[model samples]
Target: MTQGPIRLDIAVGYATPRKGLPSAVSFRRWATAALAGRIREADLAIRLVGSKEGRALNRHYRGKDYATNVLSFPADLPEGLPPGVRMPLLGDLVICAPVVAREAREQGKSLNAHYAHLTVHGALHLLGWDHEDSREADAMEQLEREILAGLGLDDPYALPGD
Candidate 1:
């Protein structure tokens, strides 16, 4: 029962505002749709931390000193697939809410839209997707655009001044 189609267990730590997060109902629908119902099981730990903690994680994991919008730590699940073997222990996502809010304000996007975008981005990473190359980035962005559109938001990539 640890994994299943869009199984999301949301855990919040630090000072992220609970009231501001997408409702459980909304999150479930969004994640399920974005994952395309392929998730056998999934879990999410969404942390809202200050810039200092964010900076530390970014430095330790990515070798970057500044706080980032999001960081994903995927679980070490078993490799390979033999029919019904599902992906478990998907991973963790850390988001600096302050940073997200600032970015949204700077980009003139709704806060919820930005949150949706980042959540989808992190979830995709858990599903074994990356954007290290232009092609990969394009693919990922296309998926993101579609996902966000389904959620009734404009293209995050096309936001003015982005």
Candidate 2:
């Protein structure tokens, strides 16, 4: 099915002078690219945050105390909307800049590439894709690989020891 245009919003809340943070244009590009052929329309927000805020959100929401790379919060609209109602709001993404940067450096991946992968990954999650099990993980990872490749990025799952 043909997809429609995308509407993305981005916010940066980190105080640290981090390097390699993607621009709003790049975020839009990555998100729109990931949503291509998947959703006809999307209204999503991407928020770049520090480890403190990221950790707080993780702890409150997922019961995890550490800051993660990316967290997805899908829209919780009613299952059945009234007639003529269009819920284009997909969800929000909270990306910890420091964590992403550190992971990219440690994993030997480019910062932009890692950000692209995470953006795509979070977008997928907003669209109801998940990796809760081996089968689901394989499928999600395959899709992520395809999406990242389309953006001229390498497979994010490749380990350095491979």
Candidate 3:
């Protein structure tokens, strides 16, 4: 079955020069690709933030002190909506550019590939995918590998010793 179009908005909140930031078109493409065969429609925001904002968000929401890669905030729609009601608002994805770049360098992965993986990962989380346990992590990683492979990207989970 064909899915409805996705509406994605990208926001840059960092003050530093975003040297390797992905274009809005690329963000939309990656998100749409991730959402394929999963949802009919999506309305989400991708916010690029600096380490400060990232850390603040993570601490406030997740109780972590340091900045992480990506944070997914799913929308909480009211329950008991009438049948046939469409909830297009999926939620927001807050990505830390510095953290992502650092991870890419440390992991020996390309910047673009790392961004793609995080984008897909964040989108999956918004779509109700999680890795709170080993089984869930395996399923999520497999799906991530499949989606990234379709985009000609290497498996994000591949370790150096593998």
Candidate 4:
């Protein structure tokens, strides 16, 4: 069944310099693509941070020392809401600009494309998609590939010779 357009109220915040970074519109587009057909409405925040803040958040949240790429924080809605009440608050996404740039350069991919992939990946995470195990990882990766392809981007997980 075809679903209607997703109603997204995405707030983009830049904790780092805006220069050489993807604009808020691009992020919103990527997020909407990820949410379309899966959700009807959403309210989420996407924060772009520098390496320092990214590293700190990663360390504090995931116990990782360095900043990875994108971090997804799903919303924790309050309990005791009336039945049939759906919360449109989808949590926040933190993207480390430096890490993304570095990875793009290292992987020989365009910066904008990398950002799109990360944004989509993070959005899926917000929707309760996880890759804690191999099976889950494969499914998530395939979904990501499909979403990116729909966005006219190359497969992010493709090998060098593929």
Give the number of the best model, judged by lDDT.
4
Q: Could you give candidate 1's per-residue lDDT for residues 2-101 as a string of tens digits?
A: 2444455656565555666656555556556666665756666666677888899999989999999888887754554446645555667788877888
Residue 147 in candidate 2, Cα distance off native in Å? 0.8
Off by over 4 Å in 3: 1-16, 77-86
Candidate 4: count of backbone clashes, pairs at least 3 residues apart or interchain: 0
Q: Please identify model 1 stretches exceeding 4 Å from their true place.
A: 1-6, 17-29, 77-87
Q: Could you estimate the TM-score for every candidate? A: 0.79, 0.85, 0.86, 0.91
- Clash number by candidate, in order: 5, 0, 0, 0
Candidate 4, residue 107: how far the Cα is off, in Å? 0.9
- Tens-digit per-residue lDDT, 49-96, candidate 2: 889999999999999999999999887545654577456767888999
List pairs with backbone clashes in candidate 1.
Answer: 3-41, 4-40, 4-41, 5-39, 5-40
lDDT of 4 by residue, 59-152 (tens): 9989999998999988854453357645788889999999999999999889999999999999999998999999999999999999999999
lDDT ranking from best to worst? Answer: 4, 3, 2, 1
Q: lDDT tens digits, residues 1-162, model 3?
A: 355664544443434456778776777778878987787776778888889999999999999999999999887544533477456768888999999999999999988899999999999998889999999999999999999999998999999667
Report each candidate's C-alpha RMSD, comma-separated, in the order given.
5.2, 3.3, 3.8, 3.0
- Please identify which of the two predictions, 2 or 4, would achieve the higher lDDT against the true structure: 4
Clashing pairs in 3: none
TM-score of 3: 0.86
